[model samples]
Target chain A: MSTAVLAAPFQAVFDANSQEFSLAGVIRPRSVDEIAYSITEFRRAIDEARGVLYINVKRLAQMNNTAFHAFSRVVLDACRTRSDIRFVVVTSSVVGWTERMFHHLGKIEPQITVEVYDSKFYPGQSFVEDTSFIPILRAQTKMTWRHERTILPRHGMRPGIAMADICCGIGDFAVLAQKEFQPARIVALDHSKPSLAYARKVAAEFGVTGIEYTYGDASEMLLEDNQFDFVTCRHSLQVFNQPELLLKELYRIVKPGGRVYITNEKNSHCLGEPRAQSIQWTYNELARLLSHFEMDVELGPKSRRYLADAGFDDILVESFMITNLDGDPQDFADVIAGWEKMFAAMAARHGEAPKFIDRFRQGFRDHIFAALHPKGYAGWPIWAASGRKPL
Target chain B: MNAAQRQPAEAKFEPLLQFEMEMGTFLSDWHHCDQLSNFMARMISHNRTDPVRHSNFFSSALNELLEVSFRGGSPEGRIGCSVFRQGPKERVRLSFPCSPTQRRFFGEAVARTHKGDAYARYLDAISTDLAPSREIVLLDLAINFDAEIRLEEDDPPSISIIVDLPLEGIVS
Candidate 1:
């Protein structure tokens, strides 16, 4: 017989059939005694479970340091001793720091699995994370001609064209295009509220008007068919699980005579060579690390084929190399910091390996000392492909 | 003689207690460094309920060293920490590579502080009100460079920070 109890800070339910235990509530336990009770109760429930010990921490909010440490200790201890039962933590997306704490606990006991349900992609509709402070720093740095040329003026952007920038984080390209081309109407679409908020603030700061920022899934954007004269999604397509579906959406949204363009990092040429040295991990190494953790991001080269398959005529794919050996120290710092944030976020999202955590810590130091070496150099590759919709 | 056999006798300190951890040297990468600070506090306290008199002092000192290293402008770097009670004293030592700018800034910060304050103002620039415990007392901070002791150092030479932690009834 399973029991349900009011564990003060937690309302734990015992699922007898599935052999699972779940905790949810405004988890703000007052004293060490309460924290101990919570852990002990959860442990007792876990000992009873036969199969997967699903400890759903999805609804836990306001967990102080003591509560978190206490609860994580139980989970870690259970993972260490119990072979008959598999311990799983169903985490919430509200707090990223909790993910880090669990990441550390999981590292201590690498056997535990932390399942975070934050996938926001389907067919061609999805959201990509661009919350790192590094992109703002990149925007502060001057734009390169090679990257700009690939997306801009190639499809003959005129003032009268209606443009839509899909998955536009901070709308840097959109803002730039708005200034240079003076497009009649530019609608920037992105799914992340925080990113869109930042993009809006930046656009407003630039005093650049006539560009509308709409928030929604890219696959099912609230846009009418054949409405936009030109559509562009940069540094985002690769992040989509179904790049082809987003392309199809792009094809459907663009006018008959209009064009659609999208680009992503080719893992090999994505960031210049210094990126590897800065982090002390080569592209191959990073790819392996990402795969080992199951991050499922689109870093591999896949845009060209998808664009062609989406039925665009006169498709053009181009590769651009940005060599920044002569860039400022601050620029290098910003770039490295950006990559560091991105890597940590990725690792946190896909359960950090207990062994790799130590190496990852050392890698940062190695990257720093290597970056500061007198002969330091940095560069990376970006791939962009554009095609016109059938008239 | 074989390399191992040829080596002279090495004096080793018998550690009463010891712990090891690694951290990034840059502070601009806030989350990385913040987690590192917490790790230091956790390790120093050994997650024990016993009051660690000068836990904040250790955190503040470590934060200062990390911030000083970041001033050198290297986007990449790491610091290795070894905390142990050796011989008659307990100490936490951090070692990492440093750039010319980092060395200069760190030296300046140390120099600018009043002798009595022990660079508290300089350290305070990066952190504030660490709320150190009453049991903790300021001790000597030693800085060492790998090459400066023997020959001309590399452009960005390696450096080390040794902070003595005087704990009553806890020392060897």
Candidate 2:
């Protein structure tokens, strides 16, 4: 059962399925009387819920002491009466005071606990946020930028337009876009604090200004709707379990007639001429390995379908190959070498057979060998897709 | 060198933003507290490490102070708010019209917030059946934010409540 109560600028909802009593919008009522209906609904939710009752205040933007006191009263009463049930107050780090305020309640009542909702939003986040993997991420961006600089213009990227780069890991692309296109505004957002810290350091060291690097979950971004002329999320969807949720946010943030651009890889299609058989075998296993971790490494060709399903129109899709020929062969080899170190560890952690891990390790080594070979051609394919929000 | 001369120079605080309105106009609507804080937070938080998170926290803290001012201040006079920044610390000074009784109330409330057991006292204050005290909000800012709060009563009829919030790296 679900019940909703509106108290002017704020609304409260009790969802039985999630056992969550959620409050959103401004709740700065002068007195407790103003939110009596919400309180009634909240009490009913407490009565209905079993096990853990979640008081979700992630979106309660502005709440006064009166409102807090009222809610705290009900929560304290409930804890005292209902010995069978425990309460978990779900707070958002985005809303800074919520965790602190609720933590006071948790301290007062042992049955009550506080959890920051966005702290564990992405499952694959830990793997990608490893600082050791940062160099490879930079190398990947350096190679991909060569193709994207040309591809972006074809997909409606131009000078003096407002743009957002969602899942902008370490923010290299935002800096590149700032220099090459001079977008009027660029908001580059990522979920990782370490990555954003590194991004800020790099931007400061390079004296690159104007890109607002922010921390955010891509699927549930805090960005305003229809604000960006162009939004780009590159090489990120394949790593997420739910690419569509992220694409939905991208579509919502882009202005009508503005485009949402994305890039993803079909890891199984990674090619090298010198060690074609070994490289192909390892690449195929790499796809399966990523799948075991709930990531879709083969999401590149499916980009068009994802965009179309997300209510986008005038879809455009293209593929590009990043070859050893694109830059110094050493850089290409380094990327593969980095991937080998990262993926081999992941495979081992997943408890893959030692033989299977060895083969997987061999493939990356062969790919690197192909990149460094005097006459060899090594290729990594990426699909670039864009769709316009209907005007 | 004199003892004062031997001390390090105080960090300079850069002016960030300031807003002023007639006390009557501010008190006319309850929503003004929310509107002012949200608007000011958005305006100043664009350059923060996490703009959204910073804005949310700044707005929450500022709204509490605004609410306290709204409820306690006299109806006729000018109300002004000025914000200043020194590194990660942000200073908010709110000046509002106050009678002697209101000033005493605010003064005592702010003084109580400086106590070591203020957090425990705050929990007790809110948990009781008695009417909530204005000090609850101040204690919240003092304990939760580790804010430095002080009162300025040099000017008659109008008093300034200054709070310094070390906000950066604290939100996350």
Candidate 3:
């Protein structure tokens, strides 16, 4: 529970359970006197706090020097007087300035520390953000596009609608959607700077326009509510430890009556010919490997349940298989090769025994061999789901 | 060199957006600082690689400059802002009415911000018993945004504060 103090253009809430005092909205008073009540309330909360006191300014969109100076005084004074409690100032990278401003405060007092909220939001971010994985991401998109292009229209995707592609790694999907759907606007957002940079470069090289590539944390995005007619977070939810948080954000951004689309993979269901048993064992182990890292590689079939729980009507969910014959068998083989490099490295880093690693490596090599063989067949399954926000 | 002397060649920057209003109208409400910065940031940031992140940083830096101008400028003449872009660098020129005293204050504050120890001086300024000075805010833009700030006073009773921000490069 928390106590709320409402101030014009801003509000302060103190959660007694967490000892966090959160300040949100615009707090740009002309002078300190204008916000004396808030300042006093802030001081009171600090006084009554114990152990650690959190000053959360993650949602503060605007603040002036006057407000900063005033709040800094209270915080500084509290630090000097209270030796038992540590002061932590929580900021967001989305706001851009809060971290720098509060970092100065941290320098002034050793007891004060600044924490950027979204820094640790994604546990599996490092694995996918590797630039070496770019080629495989492109190939995977090429394989999925054959199915999604037809499936998207049935899920309410139409030309001239405003759309957002959350977690748009390297942004190939946005570029393809722009050509096919002609969205009035496209905001392709991702947390990886390198990926976004590559995406922008690719868009520029192709002379693609109208897609606004942006950097953001998907779970705690700064995007305003109800902004887009269609919001798609593709092959992303499975990578997060908390898929519900991502689903909540997707639900928040889509307009009323608009739809939220998502796609994920069930690694354990991936199948190949001839060496089918080895492939099944390896994929089951792959799911466990990802689970150990707080990721859900088996979230494909669970998409419908996730969307329904997120409060959407007219739920639609379907599955598609990307076989070696989708377009070119080489593309399918190349994707497995990339996955082998990434997952094998990850398993090694997790300290798996060399014998287990060898067997794991063999499964991928066999899968790739099957993908490239003349009489062999290999398939990867994906689930595409969407739900409409209630009107 | 002074702001006027250090001004980049006009042809190098392409102007993106500009807004003008009477200083009296602008200073009448403190909210204008937030509103104008946010509006301008959104309008200019769409074409950038990461529009949302760029706009957040741009708005924060622009809001500080506007707040400083609101506090230090004379409320009698027009206040105009023009934004320009050159590659990753974005430039904002704020021209407003000022008294001779206000001009000296901004001139010295901007100069102080360019000093090597501006971050330390900013910390000292904010921690003092007195109210936060305009220098503290200016140093914020200079230090945090890695901005190049200058004051141009060629027009009498009116001065232009020019801030060149590498907004895209800074955010990441």
lDDT of 2 by residue, A85-155 (tens): 99999887766677788898987889999999887767667798788889999999999999999999999
Candidate with more favorable, higher DockQ: 1 or 2: 2
Q: For residues A250-272, what per-residue lDDT tens digits would candidate 1 score against the true structure? A: 99778887888776665534343
In DockQ terms, which candidate is top?
Answer: 3
lDDT of 3 by residue, A168-219 (tens): 9999999999999899999999888789999999999999987998888888
State each model's CA lDDT, in order. 0.53, 0.87, 0.88
Docking class of 3: acceptable
Taking the candidates in order, what DockQ does each have?
Answer: 0.01, 0.39, 0.45
Order of candidate numbers by DockQ, starting with the best:
3, 2, 1
Interface RMS for model 1? 20.4
Best-performing candidate as measured by lDDT: 3
Better of 1 and 3 by TM-score: 3
**Which lDDT value does model 1 have at B165?**
43
Q: Is candidate 1 or candidate 2 better by lDDT?
A: 2
In candidate 3 chain B, what residue range of length 10 has the lowest lDDT sum? B1-10
Model 3 Cα displacement at A73 (Å)?
Answer: 1.5
> Which prediction has more favorable DockQ, 2 or 3?
3
Looking at model 2, residue A321 earns an lDDT score of: 97
- What interface Cα RMSD is found for model 3? 5.1
Chain A TM-score compared with the true chain A, each model in order: 0.60, 0.92, 0.92
Clashing residue pairs in all predictions, respectively, total 11, 0, 0
